[model samples]
Every structure is written in structure tokens, then in C-alpha cells.
Target: MEFRILGPVQVYDECTGVLIVPSGAKQRALLGALVVKAGQVVPAERLVDELWGQCPPTNAANALQAHVARLRRLLPCGEPGSGRPHHEWLVTRPLGYALRLGDADTDAGRFRRLAAHGRELARDDPGAAAGVLRQALALWQGPALQGSGQGTICAAEAALLEENRLVALETLYDASLLAGHCHEVTGELEELVVAHPLRERFYELLMTALHRCGRQAEALGTYDRARRRLAHDLGIEPGPALRSRMESVLRRQDPAGAAEGAARAVAGPATGTGPVDEARTADDAVAGAVSVRMLGEELARLRGHVDRLTREHRELAGRLDRLTSSPVAGPRDLAS
Candidate 1:
């Protein structure tokens, strides 16, 4: 069986090829809550609070039980000869109910697994990572837990799922760029920047794509737009990574005189025996100074890149820690 919560609360029987859908909104919400907390017993009282919020019926427990019974009927049965009851999927514990998905798969689970795999591949084979991430993203049919209403647990889980989806998208673009598909992803990155204007990383990637495609002017323009958006929205400047990208673009457009001076500086003073030799020596010193300054600037840019990457790595690690930790209080704990 496949219990999918990436888009909607749905269960599909792989053996019979039949889809089992809940009959009502509350029922769907119940399934969503259980699926998100599958393998754990959710206290009856917590379930009541999730189902009806502060407006639960006087006999809320009875109502919850009734709903659970009806939902069980709609679920798929176990393997034909296993002698397992269909209701075994929805087990009744001493505390409350638990959705025991022994061998079933959930789309959300598959997405997370594939996304992790893709991220691992990103460090080695970005092209392959892009393909895996695309497959992970394709699993989403629509907004997560759609039709599950706005119950607290469902709402929180849905938001987390949506966040995971966006992160996957960012990784996908990153992989695409690393695979040297900058020209192809430029348009998509532009759309992403417009859609998520606050995401500075998208702007950074877009700038790089444009610059690599020889659209230096457009890249600078993108930087300007990103700077404006950051200032207007958050009363701040672009982050280090974005600023570094703009600096790179500017450096790329430096006049040929700069390169010629650096070259001359490396070639050193010409051997001669006249006033011209002295003048050339002085010129070489000035050019050599310019070369040193340019080297310092390049070193600073590289440092900024390192700092930005370190910050991003820390941030991603923190997010991963939060995601792996228990997201919510246990049902018994919630009741207390």
C-alpha cells in the first residue's frame, strides 16, 4: 500500500491498483495527522483537539471514534493470506490510535530519501543529482496535505513539507548550474528570483548564470534589482555571497589596460643602459604595485566565498537537525 501525504491524504493499494480516499474533510484531516505521525500512538484527546479544534462536540471522544471506525472501513486490507485485518493498519493502543504502516510507502518519505540521496550526489555528480532531485520534486502533485483543512498538526506539517520542497528546488538549480547548464537554467533562475525575491541565493545563482552567458550588463542589473529588493523588503544589503558575485562580474569587465599592466608587471623591467631604462623601471614598479593590489582583491573575494559557504553550510546543518528531531510533542505529553 502507498499512503501519500505529499499532496493529499490518499492511500493506494499496490496489489489491487485501487485508490482509497477518505469520504470527508475531517476524515482526510484525521488521516493526514495520523500519516504524519505514523508509528506513534496519538492520544484520543489530542486527536479531538486536532479534528475539531476549540469547537469540539460535547461527545468529542465518541465522535472521534466514529470517524476512526469509518476511516478504517475505507482503508485497504492486508495481504490476501496474511490473515491481517484491514483495521490493523489503524491500531488502537491503550493511549490512543496509531497508523501502523509496516511495509507501506509514503510519498513524503520517498521525497526526503531521494532528496538526501540527491544532495549526497551533488558533491560528486551534479548531473546525476539534478536527475534524482527532479524525480523527487515530481512526486509532489500539489500543495501538501491538500484538503486536510487547517488543523494545527496538519498545518504545521504541511508548512514543513512545503519548505522541504523549496529547498529541493534550490538544490536542483544549484546542481543544474554546477553541471554547466547555466545558459539553460538562466530563464528558470530568473523566474525563481521573481517568485522568491527574498531568497538571495537565487539572485546570486541568476547573476552567475547571466555573467557566464556573457550577459554582463544584465548580471549587474540583476545585482541592482536584488540590492533594491533586499533594502526595500528587509532594510538590509545583499549578503556576502551575492555581493561577491557582483564584484566578480565587475572584475570580469575590467579594461584591457589592467590585464596589460599585470602582464608587464610579471615580465619585469627591460634590460637597458639609458634614461629610458630608468623610466621603464619606475613604470614596472607602479605596474607591480597594481598587480599586488589586484592579487589582494582576488584573495579577499575568495575569502568572502569561503565565509559565505561556511555560513550556508552551518545554516543547512541546523535546518537538518531541526528536521530530524521530533517535530511535535507526543500525544500523551500534549494532553498533560
Candidate 2:
């Protein structure tokens, strides 16, 4: 049996071509809660709280039990004498219930595993990584846990799953760029930039793709748009990576001159040179010194960016801890 919760909550039996889906919204929510926290006993109180949320019925426990019974009957019962009973899939514990998946496959689990594998492949085999990541993304039929009741657990899990999907998308773009598919991904990256204006990484990738395709002017224009958006929305400037990419576009037109200048600056005074040569060497040394100072400033900015990212990461981790520890009130559009 393959339990699917990536989209609608349903259980499929490949052997018999049977699809068992809980018809009730609450039942789907109940099954979703169990599936997300599968292999562990979710306390009865938590389940009740998620179902009714501050307005639970007087006999909430019994009502919950009734719902569980209906869900169990709706699930598949394995084989007649296979020794694997349907009840084994949803077992009642002293405090609550557990979904013992046993050998059953889940699209969520497979998507995560495949995403990890694709990330690993991204370093050395980006083409292969793109393929694997596409496969992982193809598992999503719609919004995660769609049609499930608007419970805290399901809502939070759906949001987290959707965030994971976005991360996988960013990884896919990275792999696509590395595999020399810049032109192909440029359109999607542009759309992503518009959809997620705050995501500076998308802007960076789009700029890079445009620059690689000899659209230097457009690339610079994209950087300007990103800069203006960041400034207007976040009251901040672009980070080091985006700024560096923009600088690359600015210097794209005179690559030979830039390379030769850098070489001359690094080489210092030429040996046995004339007075004019010595003067030019001195100029080159001054340019080198200026370049070194500019690089130091850029490094300082990068360090600040790193520090900001670290603080943001810590804040997000703390928020996640709180979300997992307690129930969040309100419904979020996970599909968005």
C-alpha cells in the first residue's frame, strides 16, 4: 500500500488497484495528523485540540474515537491471511494512536529522500541533479494535504512542505545554471523574481543567466530592479552575492582590459624599464592599492551579510521550535 499525503490524503493498494480515501474533512485531518507524525503516538488531547480548536465538544474523546474507528474501517486490510491486519496500520496506544506504516511507501518521504539525493548530485553532476530534482517535484499533485481540515498540525506541515518545495526549486535552478542551461531557465527565473520579489537569489540567478546570454544591458537592468525593490520593500540594499553579480555585469564589456589591468597591477614594476614605463608601473601600483582597499570594503560588506544571515537563521530556528512545541492558530494558504 502507498500512503499519499503530498496532495490529498489517500491510501493506494497496488496489488488490488484499490484507493481508500477518507471522505470526511475531519477524518482526512485525523489521518493527515497521524501520517505526518507517523510511527509515534500522537496524544489524544493534541488530536482533539487540532480538530476542534478551543471549542471541542463535551465528549470530545468519544467523538475522536468514533472518527478513528471510521478511518480504520475505510483503510485497506492487507490480505485475508497475510497476518498483517488493517488495524495494525492505525494502532491505539495507552495515550493515543500511531500509524505504523510498516512497508508502505509515502510520497512525502520519497520526495524528501529524492531531494536530498539530488542536492548531493548537484555538486558534480548537475544535469543528473536537475533530472532527479524534477522527479522529486513531480510528486506534488497540488497543495500538500489539500482537502484536509484546517487544523494547526496539517496547516503547519503543509507550509513547511511548501517551503521545502521552494528550496528544491532554487536547487533546481542552481543545477540548471551549472549544467549550462542558463538560457532555458531565464524565463522561469524571471517569473520567480516577479513572484518572490524578496528572494534576492532568484534575481542573482536571472542576472547571471542574462549576462551569460550576452544580454549585459538587461542583466544590469534586472540588478537595478532588484536594488530598487529591496530598497523600497525592505529598506535595505542588495547582499554581497547580488552586488557582486551586478559588478560583474558592469565590467562585462571590457574583459580583456580588466584582465590585463589586473595582471599589470599584480606584476608590479616591470624590470629594466624606461622612465615612462616606471611612471606607468607606479600608476599600476596605485591602482592595485585602490583595488585592495575596495576588496577590503567588499569583504566587510560580505561579513556583515553573513552575520545578518546567521541571526536570521537563529530567529527562524527559534520560531520553528515554538511552532513545533505548540499549536498555531489561524489558517494559511499553503497552496500559495
Number of clashes in every candidate structure?
0, 0
Candidate 2 Cα deviation (angstroms), residue 249: 2.0
Question: Would you list the clashing residue pairs of candidate 1?
Answer: none
lDDT of 2 at 18: 78
User: What lDDT score is found at residue 257 in candidate 2?
Assistant: 39
lDDT of 2 by residue, 88-143 (tens): 68899999999998878889999999999999999999999999999999999889
Quality of model 2 by C-alpha lDDT? 0.83
Task: Give residue 198's error in model 2 in angstroms.
Answer: 1.6
Relative to the true structure, how large is the alpha-carbon lDDT of every model? 0.83, 0.83
Q: Kindly list the per-residue Cα lDDT of model 1 for residues 1-336, writing each as its tens digit.
A: 889988878998877688888979999999999999999999998888888998999999889999999998888666567555544789888889999888888999999999999999998999999999999999998999999989888999999999999899889988998999998999999998998999998998899888778776688789879877886889667888987887777655333334454565567646544444544555455445544664576467568868989999999887666655857756664444
Error of model 1, residue 30, in angstroms: 0.4
**Pairs that clash in candidate 2:** none
lDDT computed for candidate 1: 0.83
Off by over 4 Å in 1: 79-87, 253-336
